[model samples]
Target: MVGSCSVRFPINLEYLHRTHPHVTTYEPEMFPGLHYRMVVPKVTFAIFKSGKVIITGAKNKMDIDNAFNQVYPILKSSIKITEIL
Candidate 1:
Protein backbone atom coordinates (compact mmCIF):
# COMPACT_ATOMS: atom_id res chain seq x y z
CA MET A 1 0.00 0.00 0.00
CA VAL A 2 0.94 3.64 -0.35
CA GLY A 3 0.22 6.77 1.62
CA SER A 4 1.28 10.40 1.35
CA CYS A 5 1.57 13.46 3.54
CA SER A 6 3.46 16.70 3.91
CA VAL A 7 5.16 18.43 6.78
CA ARG A 8 4.80 22.15 7.45
CA PHE A 9 8.31 23.13 6.40
CA PRO A 10 10.82 22.32 3.74
CA ILE A 11 13.40 19.62 4.30
CA ASN A 12 17.09 19.74 3.55
CA LEU A 13 17.92 16.63 1.64
CA GLU A 14 21.67 17.07 1.82
CA TYR A 15 21.72 17.28 5.59
CA LEU A 16 19.35 14.34 5.89
CA HIS A 17 21.45 12.18 3.63
CA ARG A 18 24.63 13.24 5.36
CA THR A 19 23.28 12.46 8.79
CA HIS A 20 21.46 9.27 7.84
CA PRO A 21 23.69 7.77 5.22
CA HIS A 22 22.80 4.26 6.29
CA VAL A 23 19.07 4.57 5.80
CA THR A 24 18.60 7.46 3.40
CA THR A 25 19.45 7.67 -0.26
CA TYR A 26 19.70 10.92 -2.21
CA GLU A 27 20.94 10.96 -5.78
CA PRO A 28 19.97 14.22 -7.35
CA GLU A 29 21.15 13.10 -10.76
CA MET A 30 18.90 10.09 -10.69
CA PHE A 31 16.03 11.12 -8.44
CA PRO A 32 14.62 14.28 -6.97
CA GLY A 33 13.54 13.12 -3.51
CA LEU A 34 15.41 11.48 -0.69
CA HIS A 35 14.55 7.83 -0.16
CA TYR A 36 14.33 6.80 3.49
CA ARG A 37 13.83 3.21 4.56
CA MET A 38 12.76 2.07 7.96
CA VAL A 39 13.10 -1.47 9.23
CA VAL A 40 10.45 -1.80 11.92
CA PRO A 41 7.45 -0.89 9.84
CA LYS A 42 9.21 -1.95 6.67
CA VAL A 43 8.31 1.14 4.73
CA THR A 44 10.07 3.35 2.25
CA PHE A 45 9.51 7.08 2.29
CA ALA A 46 10.12 9.21 -0.74
CA ILE A 47 10.76 12.45 1.04
CA PHE A 48 11.11 15.64 -0.95
CA LYS A 49 12.60 19.01 -0.23
CA SER A 50 9.08 20.41 -0.09
CA GLY A 51 8.38 18.14 2.89
CA LYS A 52 6.13 15.91 0.85
CA VAL A 53 6.48 12.27 1.78
CA ILE A 54 5.28 9.30 -0.22
CA ILE A 55 5.13 6.13 1.79
CA THR A 56 5.30 2.67 0.27
CA GLY A 57 5.28 -0.95 1.43
CA ALA A 58 2.82 -0.42 4.20
CA LYS A 59 0.09 -3.00 4.67
CA ASN A 60 -2.60 -0.80 6.15
CA LYS A 61 -3.48 2.58 7.56
CA MET A 62 -2.06 1.56 10.87
CA ASP A 63 1.24 0.67 9.30
CA ILE A 64 1.33 3.97 7.47
CA ASP A 65 0.54 5.87 10.64
CA ASN A 66 3.09 3.93 12.57
CA ALA A 67 5.75 4.56 9.97
CA PHE A 68 5.03 8.27 9.84
CA ASN A 69 5.05 8.56 13.59
CA GLN A 70 8.34 6.76 13.77
CA VAL A 71 9.94 8.99 11.18
CA TYR A 72 8.71 12.40 12.32
CA PRO A 73 11.14 12.73 15.20
CA ILE A 74 14.02 11.50 13.11
CA LEU A 75 13.27 14.19 10.56
CA LYS A 76 12.93 16.83 13.22
CA SER A 77 16.20 15.83 14.82
CA SER A 78 17.91 16.03 11.47
CA ILE A 79 16.79 19.61 11.19
CA LYS A 80 18.49 20.36 14.47
CA ILE A 81 21.65 18.79 13.16
CA THR A 82 21.39 20.91 10.04
CA GLU A 83 21.08 24.00 12.17
CA ILE A 84 24.15 23.02 14.16
CA LEU A 85 26.39 22.42 11.18
Candidate 2:
Protein backbone atom coordinates (compact mmCIF):
# COMPACT_ATOMS: atom_id res chain seq x y z
CA MET A 1 0.00 0.00 0.00
CA VAL A 2 1.10 3.54 -0.69
CA GLY A 3 0.59 4.91 2.78
CA SER A 4 0.14 8.66 3.05
CA CYS A 5 -0.01 10.47 6.37
CA SER A 6 1.45 13.21 8.49
CA VAL A 7 1.80 12.84 12.23
CA ARG A 8 1.97 15.60 14.77
CA PHE A 9 3.20 15.03 18.27
CA PRO A 10 3.14 17.45 21.17
CA ILE A 11 6.62 18.28 22.31
CA ASN A 12 8.57 21.11 23.84
CA LEU A 13 11.45 22.90 22.18
CA GLU A 14 13.96 21.69 24.71
CA TYR A 15 13.14 18.07 24.14
CA LEU A 16 13.11 18.37 20.35
CA HIS A 17 16.46 20.14 20.26
CA ARG A 18 17.98 17.59 22.57
CA THR A 19 16.64 14.62 20.68
CA HIS A 20 17.11 15.56 17.02
CA PRO A 21 20.38 17.38 17.04
CA HIS A 22 20.99 16.74 13.38
CA VAL A 23 17.88 18.69 12.43
CA THR A 24 17.85 22.45 12.13
CA THR A 25 15.70 24.53 14.44
CA TYR A 26 14.19 27.85 13.45
CA GLU A 27 11.94 30.37 15.15
CA PRO A 28 9.92 32.61 12.93
CA GLU A 29 7.84 35.44 14.38
CA MET A 30 5.26 35.24 11.63
CA PHE A 31 4.44 31.69 12.68
CA PRO A 32 4.23 32.98 16.25
CA GLY A 33 5.86 29.83 17.63
CA LEU A 34 8.77 27.45 17.44
CA HIS A 35 9.39 25.06 14.59
CA TYR A 36 11.88 22.37 13.61
CA ARG A 37 13.34 21.46 10.24
CA MET A 38 14.84 18.04 9.79
CA VAL A 39 16.39 16.40 6.77
CA VAL A 40 16.70 12.68 7.31
CA PRO A 41 18.13 10.73 4.40
CA LYS A 42 15.24 10.64 1.92
CA VAL A 43 12.75 12.74 3.89
CA THR A 44 12.26 16.15 5.42
CA PHE A 45 10.19 16.85 8.51
CA ALA A 46 8.81 20.07 9.85
CA ILE A 47 7.34 20.28 13.36
CA PHE A 48 5.16 23.19 14.38
CA LYS A 49 2.81 24.42 17.06
CA SER A 50 -0.33 22.65 18.31
CA GLY A 51 1.69 19.51 17.71
CA LYS A 52 1.41 19.74 13.95
CA VAL A 53 4.14 17.93 12.06
CA ILE A 54 4.58 18.21 8.30
CA ILE A 55 6.61 15.49 6.58
CA THR A 56 7.60 16.01 2.96
CA GLY A 57 10.26 15.47 0.35
CA ALA A 58 10.22 11.79 1.13
CA LYS A 59 11.25 9.03 -1.21
CA ASN A 60 8.40 6.75 -0.14
CA LYS A 61 5.36 6.51 2.07
CA MET A 62 6.78 3.82 4.34
CA ASP A 63 9.59 6.11 5.35
CA ILE A 64 7.07 8.72 6.43
CA ASP A 65 5.01 6.18 8.36
CA ASN A 66 8.05 4.82 10.10
CA ALA A 67 9.11 8.27 11.16
CA PHE A 68 5.64 9.00 12.45
CA ASN A 69 5.55 5.76 14.44
CA GLN A 70 8.94 6.42 15.89
CA VAL A 71 7.74 9.71 17.32
CA TYR A 72 4.19 8.61 18.10
CA PRO A 73 4.75 7.95 21.79
CA ILE A 74 6.31 11.31 22.39
CA LEU A 75 3.07 13.24 22.09
CA LYS A 76 0.85 10.43 23.38
CA SER A 77 -2.83 11.30 22.76
CA SER A 78 -1.91 14.69 21.37
CA ILE A 79 -0.69 12.97 18.25
CA LYS A 80 -2.65 13.35 15.01
CA ILE A 81 -2.20 11.72 11.63
CA THR A 82 -3.50 13.23 8.40
CA GLU A 83 -3.53 11.26 5.15
CA ILE A 84 -4.12 13.80 2.43
CA LEU A 85 -2.44 16.56 0.49
Q: With candidate 2 superimposed using the best TM-score fit, by how many Å does residue 48's alpha carbon deviate from the native?
A: 1.3
Clashes of each: 0, 0
lDDT of 2 by residue, 10-81 (tens): 445445555556664645545533443434435555555455666666567777777667655653533222
lDDT at 46, model 1 = 98
Global fold similarity of model 2 (TM-score): 0.52
Q: Score candidate 1 by lDDT.
A: 0.89
The TM-score values for the models, in the order shown, are 0.89, 0.52
Q: Give the CA lDDT, 0 to 100, for residue 32 in model 1.
A: 100
